[model samples]
Target chain A: MTVTTTRLRGVEAAPEADTVPLGRRRRWREDAVEAVLFAAGFVSILTTGAIVVVLGKDALHFFRNPDVSLVDFLTGTVWQPQLGKFGLLPLLNATLMVSGIAMVVALPIGLSIAVYLSEYATPAVRNRLKPTLEILAGVPTVIYGYFALTFVTPILRWALGARTVDIYNVLSAGLVVGILVIPLVASMSEDALQAVPRALREAAYGLGATRLETSLQVVVPSALSGIAAAFMLAMSRAIGETMVVAIAAGAGPRLTANPLRSAETMTGYISRISGGDLSYNSVDYDSIFAIGLALFVITLGLNILSGRIVRRFREVYE
Target chain B: MTALAPGSIGLATSDAARQVARRHRVGRAGLAVFQLSTIVGIVVLGALLYNIANEAAGLVAYEHKTDPAAVLPGGRDLAALSAPELAAVLTANLSPGEVATLEREAPLAERSQAELRRLVDERVLETHAAAAWNLTDSVLDRPAIEATVAERHPDADLRLTSWLSPAFVTAPQSGDAEYAGIRTAILGSLWVIVITMAVAVPVGVAAGIYLEEYADHTRWLNRAIQTNISNLAGVPSIIYGMLGLAVFVRALEPLSSGGAFGAADPTTANGRTILSAGLTMALLILPLIIINAQEAIRAVPSSLREASFGLGATRWQTIRHHVLPGALPGILTGTILAMSRAIGETAPLIVVGMSTYITFDPSSPFDKFTTLPGQIYQWTARPQPEFHHIAAAASVVLLVLLVALNASAIYGRNRAQVRY
Candidate 1:
């Protein structure tokens, strides 16, 4: 889906300029293509409004009519929707816990992969290594969910005990999600690491820095903003992940820190209750919005932060 | 390159030093570990491809296992099955749940219950309905698998024959595994991506074009928009979902049909409709497309634009004729990468409303639908183990589609790159 649109728009945008150098009528045709292309993209923008406006409006509905008290929604720890009590802390905690777990797990492995690809591996090795990491980027979350549920959960259970992992546990979700985030981090961090100009690294190496030191200090510092954006990207991905958590993470929302436990993140709760029969205007329905709204705010903050970090600080030689 | 060379080396001594440095950089002990991680990434990706392809192959194997007369797609192994033959295969493996639905249609409580039960359940023999259930097993043994499947009940067509299931392309999902397909997910993904391009491309390109052609980088608002777009990329997808939930689903419910699939309340479209969820997903991935597009546009050289100006072309004309084409490949690559990211996105959609089991084909734009990832989520969450295989199959479908998209985009760029 992502690949198609980019290709479509890219193809639509740039063909004529390459083919013909200059002419008034042809330029008109080019502008026409540009206009059509822009119009098409503009249409996408309007449609995109549907996502924001639709969700924003629905979220507003939840805010507009709250059957459950806001305080209860925010502060209450237990979230069993059957009785209609809507405490969001569990969802919040789940989102954070999963994000935290993913970061802890993904950072090392993703950075390692990035380092291996960007710093260590030869070009042939990097070529093979890069796309391998990239393939992870393309694997659907559904596959990851199955892996997490069938493979990861059972292993975690065996390593600890059956009690250590529930049919749907936060750790399992987090673990799978961490695997998902690894590609995000590794790919982006590799870019960030690579973006550290060879000159800068050479300057550092000229000072007698080891390859490891060159990577740790020069490359990392030089690409700090990009790496920061990558972290933010991973965080947003962790927060947004659905299938892994939905499959392996528990549906029950609980506010707690035990990694070896069952809990629901905002997404898990949405998947659980939405799939079940529910009245549209019911608080149970509205609760998803509240949770969604919370998710939106956090990820939006992170996404914007990532963009800013890249734009504000990351240097571009070109 | 010269700076990277280790200093002062006799050949053997240099080799020894290089080996030591190689060992130090990736020490034999840690090197083994690093190698494992590298191998793990490659193997993991390979496994994903192998697993998906392997699982989807089940469709063929399962087809052959069911009937000797079965013909694969694009193959003329055998002609169409007779009606009874279709019925034989469908009834043979019809699950307990499927059998019940078939009973609902045929009300065969006094008829073939024992036979049907034997076919589906090993130890189950209750009453049976002679009424036609949608399918049994592999369905090729009985021609009625095709016959009953071809019946024009709107939802009934969902029961696709294993050999020639049009439902694979057109059907919505059903609770029964045999009847289920990726149609809705495919459509949902298609629609959301289409809509996302609708949303992201223009503003993205305009922003891209403007940043490249018009916007004064010296100004604060321009800078602000730049910062905003970049930040938008970093925004958690759930945030977009929340925004959509708050905005589109809630606010646009009037425009959105309710009683979605006749399940939820009539006034409010169930949270999981395409319009709502797609819109949310669009917002979630908007910044990415725009950023990539902007970068692509920026890659176009300025000299062409100057040449156009020298020839008396307007600014727009110069950009249209001279600049945009130069950057087309880059922009396409950017959008492809962004689309990959969007397709992989689940967070925002979850926040807004993507469901696991949408049994109806989403007919209206306002109609609720489930995507592959969403359906896979439903399947994987089940306590039953077979659902894992279903999830794997769906994953393969999604991956193939994404890769196709990515590859085509790259191909377009590479092909055009020769001209450049």
Candidate 2:
């Protein structure tokens, strides 16, 4: 395609265009383009950084009131927005609870599929399943929200027994979100699995090791950090998920880890407050930013940690 | 095709036996599972399509069913009872089959009196005759008694159609299922996404250029920027919304957040406007764009750069003339994915204050916006049976749009790959 395009554009024929040893004018034009592009890129960072600062200032502004204590905001389990208090743990608890549940469910199924695609499956199986797996990514989170509400919730209630209005329960959302996040773990793990030298797989096979055992004992162990990194990435996504938690788990912030109880994640709280009427400095409203700041810190931590681990893991590689 | 034949059409069995088969016994069990499950999977796919498409077709039974005993000897006028009112009449006596069907279709966690009240509200019941009934929505609750009672009541309404009304999609969201539409929310989402991409792309790509071409990697500030970028990508998008809440909303609260727009105090109003929303979304996607663009630039063969260098080309000259063009595809892919995520994202928008009942399109970047998913969340939470059903329909639309966007991105990536 490059060959065809170069020919069609007559880039090869412009010999004199290349011979002029890029003059001052040419250099200036290039520098100008580079400068503009660089500014454009820096602007996104500026925009994002600016947003962080904005949210921080507003969230912190809520603390300026004598009534809001930093102690109450951090350790308080009861998140009563109607009162002037700013305790955020209940929502944070909900966020972490669901994320933890999703990770547990996503890790094994995703890793199995990753192994199946990368090591266990024949080429024909691998070729078809990989793209189908990725389709899970394309399906919108809102659609997954519906599927979780409609499909998974009822089945869960039946299994868990009656009175389970545990129907719009956290378990269902986390379980479905886990399923939806399968590709993230599976695809990245597949890449990491494939990155392991083929010679290792061949060596194990030569020793009469079964494919399953080889994948379990050798490939996964070698790429543990990469797999863990992918899991963390998926965890970040599940934690940030909004519609599913909103539609299925509900919008009432609470500090309980009980899957059966209706509770709000940080995302759900933000979605709820945003949709409703809120006076900006009305402490309940500013709590949305408080939650947002917390979410940002958590996710940012996860991403950097993954990068650091990946870096260290890569260093261990050739 | 494979299922119809005992042997798959393309298998080379005899040649395989002649060449390498020590034992000729076929592992036909595995083949059988493959062929059998392929058909099963297809059937399931077809069933899902049939169910979803049937609902989406918007087919409705216009005739409202009424109890002759309750309606009196002459029977009730379907036109007198709006959609919710008609549903209320049947609510007390919904057949077990009908109840089960409704339960299957309207599965929103709670089944208490409050939920029941949501559908039977004066506002909703008064307009029951005006509601639309799709395949899943009251498939059994046919509007059977459409005959007008003009002699008895001059204020009676008309029951005109049976197929899903065209108005079902164009109308803004309403408590009545018949008038429910995602148009406003969909438009709001489009505007927000457009503004988001507008702010995010140019800035993200420019940052990529600075890092790739201009900045010295050895500089501590540059390294800090790089580390933070990778870090920023990991940061939960809600945090950006928090950031927006702090800076954009608080700093400009008086102008954007409060006042007639539903605020008790101007000082408390966080300026969670569309501009702030856009900035927040830009922050969420920027890291991806920068990283992807940088990699795309790095992918350009060093030989081209060296050739230009040999000819006395400036560092910037080699990139502008050759590298930028080569990296376009990678940049496009990242930008599209980031944009798609921004479109679907509900977390930060919630943090930055998207509304649920926005009747008008966001008039400016500073206007408060209601996104598709945000509205979908609101719809899902509504107590009415019809709104719950409509949520599925709207989700289908969102899914189709997302798929189309992602598909185009995939096509773009392939084209770019081919270009290189």
Candidate 3:
């Protein structure tokens, strides 16, 4: 009798079930929440789109100006906007000089620190030292700019003589920038080194190899791709760093390789130009966007390449 | 194992022994070099702090255009005077035209003692730093500094000045370095950061949730969003500045300037307001926050979610009740870090047109403003040696704020670790 009644009720419920709401409100709410979350996630993509659109539009406007030729902007050696010379070489050269100096100073020290931290230090020592390195990393770059201008510049002048070093030389700026990037390089390289499997180290030790030899030969070689990615990322950062170079690397655009001479970088030039009172829609005003577009492209390419290398490295290890 | 080369088994020879010893020596040397390389970063950090400290405190030689005693009645002490007395002193000492101008700006009688005192110093006494020595020189080579001051600024009165004193913190900026302070800059930073946090925290967390919880790996749009965020993380900060300039400062001028709300300051009705700066900073740190929050959420054990689902909880309910609480500490850590980064950022704000000489506190998001880092950059760019000293003091303040923020982040991370 109970089974017959339940079957009669189910037959009655089945007829209206298609029209009845079965947690439809809850499902609608869930979809709404997911949509909101998706919108939030989509904002990042919107930001990228906005950046590309804004930079591309202004850069196009800059290039379209009859006085500003794309060829001259890229290939010319001069960057004097006052004389209608929009050459990018001077700024690009200074950027390379500063970044090169930074790499020169950071690479060996940062890698060595990584090797020591991963292979040599006890866990306790690692715990204590890691935060110190982070503190170094957390320092504001504007402070580094101040240090570059007042402290590093004066010391360079005293060491290399006042005449040999200009008050605002790329050497001082680059050296301080190197110091600013040291913790970055060290931490990233350390992450890569720490990711190397311990079995590789044991294998080297099993062969009666010294710790240094194992680190330098077995472990570092295995982690080479990760290390290279770190280097590339750091290089990109140094290229994009603004305040330190703006403060100590001088304000003039000069195409020179001498580290002692003051020269402006692309970032520094953008900063200098934007800081001034340039009227809207002027060639000078739009030129900064063109330079910014170049900066964006270069850094983005390097970052994408670094990400690829890192992904490949992860695949190899995982 | 079969017949090997004859010279391969010569391991116990004296030459081999020497080779082993040399290798050991090289290993020791390399260890030392690597250790030293590690120490170099710490040493550089130490030197940087020391350098800033050296510049922030020192002996200063002041040359007053009119001595404070000359402006006061019976040469009374300036500190002991009442606000009214200070106002009287200002009125008596300043030119009639200057007094009228001051009254037009604000009534002197209504001003606080500190305000009156600042006015007296700025207009009446004009106490300029004729010479300054760094802390190192002041302590170690006092006699030389004194001698140099005496030789160069004979009429100057010499005294020790800590540029980061309470008076300096309370005072507003001035054209003269002797009276410039970071009070306005601090307020501006607070206002900007508040707006940044309000916008970034929820949106960033939601984005993280979407990516970690709702995103399907098979979907190309989700993958593109993921890739785009990572790329955005690596984009140069200055590029963000350009975006802010084009979008916030120009394209959305009406909204950013508060003109849409009819709250815009007529003097600063353009888009280069704190709102624009804060929004730009939010975008700048959004990717960072998203990445961190995703990691935190991903670390939440799957068992918790499984249990929530077993209880018939929906995906949103599971996240809201079970996962979010577990990830809160990690999210807090990331938020603090992003805050510190935004606070220290100067380039984007500069491009967004932070006023270098803004003296008034930012009362709302629509006001023109400067931040500590922006003020430091401006002062450091100044040709005056005195400005550099104050810039160092401002740097010290900024560093302390960052250290506090970072310490809290570390503390939060530790708590998160203990929980799981």
- For every model in order, what is the number of clashing pairs? 79, 33, 0
Go through the candidates in order and give each one's C-alpha lDDT. Answer: 0.65, 0.68, 0.90
Q: What TM-score would each prediction reach against the true structure?
A: 0.71, 0.74, 0.93
Candidate 1 residue spans exceeding 4 A from truth: A1-75, A80-87, A203-210, A221-225, A274-280, A303-318, B1-33, B47-172, B184-203, B258-273, B276-278, B340-366, B418-420
Q: Is candidate 2 or candidate 3 better by DockQ?
A: 3
Candidates by lDDT, descending order: 3, 2, 1
Model 2 misplacement above 4 A: A1-35, A44-48, A83-87, B1-166, B250-273, B361-368
- In what order do the candidates fall by TM-score, top score first? 3, 2, 1
Tell me candidate 3's fraction of native contacts, as a decimal between 0 and 1. 0.85
How should the candidates be ordered by DockQ, best one leading?
3, 2, 1
lDDT of 2 by residue, A1-318 (tens): 975875655655476566665453234356577668656655645755675776687678767768777788889878876676467788888888888888887787777677766765789877777656655666667767766776667678888885855656888888777777777888898899889998888888787555555777888899888998998899988898777887888767776768987788888888777666666557766666666767777776787778777878762546
| Every candidate's CA RMSD | 12.1, 13.1, 5.0
Error of 1 at A81 (Å): 5.4
Candidate 2 interface RMSD after superposing interface residues: 5.0
TM-score top scorer: 3
Q: B36-137 in candidate 1: lDDT tens per residue?
A: 776766666665565444443222111222323232223322234333433444555556687678667665444353333223322122111112321223
Best by DockQ: 3
